[model samples]
Target: MTGTTPTAWQQRIDTLLHALADARRDAAAAQAREVALLAEAVEIAQAMAQDAGGPTSVADIPMRSLAAQIGAAARVSDRTVQKHMSDAVVLVERFPATFATWAAGDISRGHVRVVVDAGVGIDDNAARAVFEDAALEVARRETPGRLKPAARLLATRLHLVPLQERHTAAATKREVWVRDLDDGMAELIAILPAAIAHGIRDRLDQYARRVIDARDTTDTRPTDARRISEVRADVFADLLLTGHASPDVSNDAIPADEAIIARVQVTVPALTAVGADDTPAELIGKGPIDTATALRLAGTATGWDRVLTHPVTGTVLAIDRYRPSDHLKRTLRVRDEHCRFPGCRIPTYRSDIDHTTAREHDGPTELTNLAHLCRRHHTLKHHSAWRVRQTPDGILHWTSPTGRHYPEHPARTLVFTTEQAGADIQTGAVSESATASDPPPS
Candidate 1:
């Protein structure tokens, strides 16, 4: 205050600026809370709808429909209502009994959506069981409003599966065609798990290797029963392995086993401060890369960081790398929860890490430099004018070079209203058509 006396007008301008900042901050917080509330309401409504089956009763009105009603009453789109409703589902899924206990206030729609999505893909009965148990536990231990994390924790414990990738360099047990199955008529062999099949294939490959080794080592002239069995297994395995390679054998063939998804976090240069809390900053995103490609990225040190045209803002800022921090990775995962491409729902868990800024241009390895793109979109990004931008709130906004922009809806942000297209609400529906009428319902 003593640095220099401001002119009267200057002091008024400074006060006005402070007031504006306070207003903006309050408005953002309010919007977030509103979204959270709408989400919770949707969840309760969805739970009732699921129980009643197709909203036949007053209590059974579908969450989306209920949201639509709310939207209509409030002069908003049913989609917005459903979005809030989905948030409700997330909340209920997180804190199952919150709908009844905190039904009047506190809990918001976003919390519900988080829970609902966390519970999705799990069988319904199983999900319900998990939800009820988690909800009760949360109610007893935590305050009424803190149910979201509790529900997520419960679901993770109940429904999460291990994501370990097992490697096998050896050949597995395989099928060898026997021309003289003439001794027996038509028969089907038993089906087996991949591990079992792999073991068999490996054993067969070993036998073949032995046969070759033996033949090459000396002038061997042996034709024994054991040898014959080994030979048969080897032949079967080879045939199974290379059936497609030789059309004369059969069109059917078993492809070599390869890991479908791989996750590895490497320490790379950090680019930006995420927030005031977390230090040792991190960034996270995913993409589809072949095993070889993934290992190559794994090998890199500095990684990538650079600025490019932000699809939304049009302003440029340094993009960060998606590297060794769980929080950063989680943010990217949620943003790109699936590939950052329109009409694609391939979840981030199965995607590869992509650079929004081309690496050749000296982009640093960072989260801003990365995005979760499935194999298809990862390739498409290189092939087309598709651009992806991650908003500060963690939404991925995608734009085609043609100027059409689309928001890649996160599963956590989904609303299950009749307003969504088809029965697959995950595919999403519209509150109203963008330009005019709806797309005639695919």
Candidate 2:
């Protein structure tokens, strides 16, 4: 029935995996065993502390020796061991439902960690139960990152504190720091407001994508071959050191302050924008953000599009251009919020609006035929063996060079990238660095 045959090593590995199915099923029970055992160890250690002395907290220490001993045996840092002990105890004691599901091996340690971290702040029994139920439902079907929005939403709903007040207080702590590393590497860290941070990254991504798109599509003898991640890093360093991305790549030396005029796709619920509720607005490739920030951004936006979605399933149904632009271009941007390629999150502002079927081959310029593709994927589609087709429903089904199919759905959103406010942010102050870094190579 089948012409293909597996190699010996592949067959052996497959057989081994299948044979261990029952062992995998017992993982939940094993987790229970470990958590119970470790929890008991914590209890005993506490008891020993009491016997050795009064006021169980000794020299302002708590369970350090026991954790250190466990760490030594487990070959991990004592802090890690102690954290594990605490998580295990918390899972069994504070989050019984989460522990039960995790013990059943339905969700992984990552999911458990996200749930615990999100719900730890909740003390009210009724609110905690509500959050756990909502969070667990999301945890079942999504990755830890995806689950964060629902977790945060539920946690926020439970909190009595108004989001606006909390946001104001947290906004005071923004700062930047740097740490030198090995191999001529250094970590530049900034604790910025979420929107600003995400916008900065989005700009970097867009800038890098443009260079990559040019490299792949250009007719000239292209010399630059850096990957997007490498390009982003280089751009970051060059911009900081010279107030511009390296001109060597694309002569993209627009000053960083000028370049700070970045556009980002933000999906704000209708009610959330008007301050009706605090359901978080989302940056498409990014996660949920506080609604106050969303309102502030939306208030001063140059223009925006109103997208209507299916009320029940959240499927985008229609898009209405709020600002005057080519309707087709705006439609494609909202529908293909990011690249149509599977797993590529490059946004539309920096990607090509591509024809799924080539115009040269009698493919018409129509909804069913057009899709957004980042430059890299566009190049791959035309120059490489990879193939893609779009359905009338706007799903881009891609067949890879190796014959695997991945279907990328149109972004399920009600609104996306707006003409951002603060476009006049100036790089004039940072322009002095242009003389510090050497000129772009000839």
Candidate 3:
């Protein structure tokens, strides 16, 4: 009976392991099939390009036509199609052995990507072939994470250029990027040289240690103090802006009496701004932030632009700006919050407030007639088949040349009027509909 029970448990464990292995195989098979399809698409694109003029120049390739066809068929964006096409060309033409290995489920798509990324800019086909051979072998034996650094090192060695030269060349590509994350936060990434990057990190760490030491000795703070990471981040920002270790630091070098005005736009509900409500505020470029942080920031604000918005509809009612143009711009900024173009999220402040119906055609300059469009979208609107119309409610309805329709609603603020608050208190239920008919809050 004991032997039978042990055998049964072993069988179940084996079954689960087999299932996971099958899933991995299935995923690999799918990737292989996708690569095959991409290869075919690339062939068709090349054939079309040749038929267009039999031209010798890269510019002669009808990329737009190819991208459009692939995008439509695959239900992907043009940029995505372009990437797929590039990958297809590289896999089928440049790394056939690696492609075969990937198709056979011996290596993952990630492994393939690492190899391809490493092989880029290698003009000599023989050198690329050698690099691919070594990289593929490394990929087959190692995880993608382990293979990437190995592949990169192989590429550098194969390049035949000095390491310092490569480092200098790569340093030119250093950049800073901001990626919006979930939960109203953002990731600010800085790609810099190793020396500079390490220096910055070490400096932040030093400041963080100082903060920890200061809190321990001078303040009766709880054991659950701000984390080392949090302190370091705050210190980094403080040093960058005010040249101080902390915001409260007052010394001969840096005076705490001087105000540090943060130049950031935050759209808060009128009631929340006045402490009547606890509704969250929308930090421009970021998403919704908590009301406490919003209130704290608002309290320290050096200047203010009072924007009155309808409590129910969340529509901009009026802007109290000193300049007429500034008022118009603020009204549009509050109304749009982002570019009105479909799927575009460029902040309204960075976007151009365009007249949907042209001024030459006698379009009014009212909020209803104006639309916020990024520079690229504005040019596309004028030149391409993208048409935009703003409804009375400020919702933008877009019509593509293919007759596809997309609607972009106005950015809504979360604010409850006195009547809506009263309704919630009486019924013990809260909903947007309860406030839909309510007058704007004072």
Candidate 4:
């Protein structure tokens, strides 16, 4: 082979990269344009409703046939099209600035998604304008996963209703439902409060870890090997079905290790912690929780952390998780909010802190060499042809088997603006403003 083969491959890669960029921009623009078309469809439905002397309200748009017609032309699901039409009305009307950004290709459809999800809580047009300006500015630079925290915080700030009040109202809507999956399996879905839900998951995870770790040491012969996920599922089922993790066929009850408890992080502002403010306390990887719930958890918590973060950048300036577990781990958890694999959003609490360089290669157990990786990605890194390196700044530069490079960054990549914190709207102001507005949830 000629020495020019490497040069040829480089040129091909450059071509692919450029094409991918163009395609992404085109796709975003297409999505932006879809909003307008969907808006027009809704308008047509409204006109039909008005002409027939029928209910002309948005919810009563009677878009079943309209959506079906559109769906036929677009070869999409009528139900999905109806849902999109509802969401489109919101984007095109309520968040024109954000829509424009997507149209201009400054961000992707995923960015719009997070913004829309967060925007629904605003319920006021002017407040949403402020939110859009702050969020869109940050959304332009960061990935959708990184944008979520900023978006959520902006949504919380812009709401006129007190978080506790809204949370209480929202809580009323919580219930569990089941959906059928393939192969005679069903997915048990629980729509619970953030704190409770996350706590349940954490507890299951801790139990799963204990079971997996003790597999080799325990004298009892295990039924079958299982991954952490499988163990967690099995434990959940066992607890729900028989009131314990493992049922004793010999009338023996296994001792519960109360010390192996779940630890959930509740990140509240110093003011909020002391009841000086009512701002929502975050459930870390989960979204905001009510102040009452936060206090309850904090009151009973065994450990405490004094985390100092940059107000504007949201950077972790310093943190002390207080637990004897490696301080490096606590710091890494705060820094790497999720797995340091491109596009992966698995929370760091459920992930492994991996050495970017193998420890066998004399990699130090320090910040630069350490980052969180979900078991899937960690296994892929070790078993597949993928390779990764971490920069001192906590960027994970991963090279695929095909030699494609994807750069993963720390979760704090979200940029915060003064508007995100409700500085623009003054007290008792948000509700009074933005009286007239638009849109529907996706």
Model 4, residue 20: C-alpha shift (Å): 2.3
TM-score of each predicted structure versus truth: 0.26, 0.68, 0.46, 0.75
Per-residue lDDT over 40-84 for candidate 3, one digit per residue giving the tens place of the 0 to 100 score:
877787777777765476643567677777788879998888788
Model 4 scores worst on lDDT over the 10 consecutive residues at 433-442
lDDT of 1 by residue, 236-333 (tens): 64556774123222112222341112133321212211222111111121211123222334344233332222222212222333443343454455
TM-score of 1: 0.26
What lDDT does each candidate get?
0.44, 0.66, 0.63, 0.73
Off by over 4 Å in 2: 1-33, 50-53, 56-62, 215-225, 249-260, 308-318, 323-442
Q: Which candidate model has the greater lDDT, 1 or 2?
A: 2
Local accuracy of candidate 2 as per-residue lDDT tens digits, 172-287: 99888889999998898999777788778867876776667776877543667689998888877776787667666444434335444566556676656665545556655455
Best by lDDT: 4
The full ranking of all candidates by TM-score, starting with the best, is 4, 2, 3, 1
Best by TM-score: 4
The alpha-carbon root-mean-square deviation between model 4 and the true structure, to one decimal in Å, is 8.1
Candidate 3 — what's its lDDT?
A: 0.63
- For model 3, the superposed segments whose C-alpha errors exceed 4 Å read 1-10, 54-63, 172-189, 198-220, 223-232, 242-244, 247-442
**Which candidate, 1 or 2, would have the higher TM-score against the true structure?**
2
- Report the C-alpha displacement of residue 322, candidate 4, in angstroms: 7.8
What lDDT is reached at residue 288 by model 1? 14
